[model samples]
Structure formats: C-alpha cells, structure tokens
Target: MQPIRVLLADDHPLFRSGLKNVLQADPAFNIIGEASRGDEALLLARGCKPDLVIMDVSMPVMDGIECTRQLKEHDPSIKVLMLSTYSDDAYWQESMEAGASGYVLKRAVDTELIIAIRAVMEGERYIYPTLLGGFHKPGGKAAADELQEEVLSPREQEVLLLIALGHTQQEIAEQLAVSIKTVDSYKTRIREKLNLTKRSDMVRYALKHNIISDKTV
Candidate 1:
C-alpha cells in the first residue's frame, strides 16, 4: 500500500503547522512539504508533485484560487482540498471552478477535512454539507453563449473558460491543441479585453460576470 503524499499550503504559518501535526497524526497521510504563499505553493507543488494539496483559499502574492488553477494546469492529477473560514458561496463556487476536488470549512469537525481529502484522492468532489442548498448549477449552451459574448475572441473565450475551470496555460495548450505561447497570447488578449488587472482579478471577473457557473467558478 502506498502512503498518500500531502503538501500543506497557507499564509498562516501557525495554522499550517497545526494542520501538519493534525494530518501527521493520521497514519494514512504523509506530510511531504509546506508552503507559505500561493507562489511558493505552486513551486513546491510542481517540484514535489504531491498526491494532495491542503491549501487555504486566501493568501498573498497569489490567492489559493489562482494557485490551484496553476497547479491543476501543471498537474491535473493532483488533488486540491480548500480549507477556508469563509462561508461565502463564491469561494465554494470559485474553488470548484478552479478544479479543486473539495471544499472544507475550517470550523468543521476534524474528520470533515479527512473525509474531504480522502474523497478527492478517490476521485470524488466533497462540499461542505451546509453549502449544498445554495450551489447553483448553470444552465446549458445558452449560458455558455452568454459567457462567449464577453468581448473575447473564440480562442480567448476558450482560454477564459479553461482558466475558470482551473487550467493553466500549459494545460490549456494541450487541451486546446495549441502551444503554451498561443495559450498565453489568448490569455493576454482576454485579460485586456476584460480589463482584468491581475491574474486573480481575471478569476474574480469570471466569477462576477457568470462567465463560469457559480458551482464551478
């Protein structure tokens, strides 16, 4: 039996340290590395290639949402579990859009996190029980077409779509049959057209404009 390798990423050092101890207490999880910022999380995640990332939704220099998007782009196989204090459905919505496997509220029972991690590793999506009533599932092609008309080109729209789904340029390139440069170009154009000021801002716009469904974005 292979042990599950886990990486802890959060801006709060004490929280991460405490979480590390909590996870290490469980024999099934192995703490492989720790990161204090979104950028560091991306770098460590890429290098360590951990099986699971337990991350915070809020962080500096990059938020967990964008970091998770980049991570999934780098390695779609890696599972991400978002640990957050926010009850805002937007976080839940954005996290799912960013390809996070699970969303666990920090105040939930300790076992909830465990369950979420295990479920994600087993190829399942876990959401906090309290949030289920409000999770909005988007309509079909009509909704997609509305998002498509947001001043982005066909390719740029595709890139924005993938970004909403938590794919990075490299991942989007392979998925769209384009080069990384091509994906970047599309992203640049999309950002400019959308008037997005930051990578995170692009995600927020995708969320605000309903470019991606609430459940996914």
Candidate 2:
C-alpha cells in the first residue's frame, strides 16, 4: 500500500520538526514537503500533491485557515487537518467551512492528531471531543435537533460555521468555492439575520443555539 503522502505547513521550525518526527515514527505517513507560510504552503501543496496537509493555524503571511482554503480550492481532494492551539468554536466552524477534514488542537498532539489525520483521509470529519461536547446538554437533545434544522442553506450554514470556526473572509472564500465579494455578501446576510455585530457574537450564537454540538462534520 502507498504511504499517506503528507505535507507539513507551519511557521515554527521547532514545532514542525517535532511533528515531523512524531508522524514519521509511524511508517504509514510520509513527510513529503514543508512550508512556513500560507502562500508557501499553497505552492508546495501544488507541487507535492500530498494526500494530506497538516498545518498550524497561526502563521505569518497567510495563516492555516487561509492556506487550507487555497489548497482546497486548488484541489478539493487534498485533505487538510488543522493543527492549532485554538479551541475556539469559531476556529472549529471555520475549519469546516474552509473545507478542512478535521480540526485537532495542538495540545492533543499524538493521540488526537493521529485520529484526526486518519479520519479526514478516509473522508470523515473530526473535532476534538471535549469541544464537541461543550455545546450540548446531557438529556435535552431537542435543542440540538432544532438547531440542526434552522434555516441557513447548507452553503450559508457552511459560511456561518466557518465564521464560528474563526476563519477570515479570504479563507472562507477559498474554502467555499466562492469569491471574497461573495463571502462578504454572506457575512452581511449572516450578521443581519442573526443581528450580530462582533465575530464573538457569532460564536456565542453557534454555541447558544447548538448549531455546532458534539456533532462531527
């Protein structure tokens, strides 16, 4: 079987090196290339054509979210699994909107990262388990169900979710197969409909309404 060809994208040399070592320890993965910025990651992704891209969300020039958008835009088939310290609901939402297959906090290094990478490669979505459960109640599944049916079109919901996940306009556009202008339009619509002002407001809406529960996607 061919190994899972993987590209590592991050601005921090030490962290990237450590992750490389960890992944390489398992022969199923191949560290094919590395990039320190979003633009560079995009270039290398195109050149390397890896099966997966493992990236850190915070970086110079273009962050992980933007890079995921660009790389996915260039080739939607290439899976992206975000590796970041951000446990924010927005970051989780944005990663999904940006078409990331999974979001694993950097703190969950070995176990969670491995699971996320594998799940995404197999066409599944993964989010850290604790974050997944934080938006839910023990018994009342009704609110969760209602939140699921609320009237955002899948694309609109996709945008909202990514906004919740902490992605920027450029990043959302890249992930959603739309233009930046279109992303702005969606943002306007979302803000108006939700009567929200700040990005934190969106995150609160998602959590409060259970738009993103312990649900994987």
How many residue pairs collide in each prediction? 3, 10
Tens digits of per-residue lDDT, candidate 2, 1-217, equal 8999999998989999999999999999999999999889999999989999998888899988988988888899999988888887788788888988877888777655764675577676666655544455444666544433343445556788888888889999888776787688667656644557897877777776666653522
lDDT of 1 by residue, 77-145 (tens): 999999999988799889989999888888873646765675578676666655544434497644543
Off by over 4 Å in 2: 136-217
Global fold similarity of model 2 (TM-score): 0.64
lDDT for each candidate structure: 0.77, 0.77
User: What is the Cα-based TM-score of model 1?
Assistant: 0.62
Identify the runs in model 1 with alpha carbons over 4 angstroms from their true place. 136-217
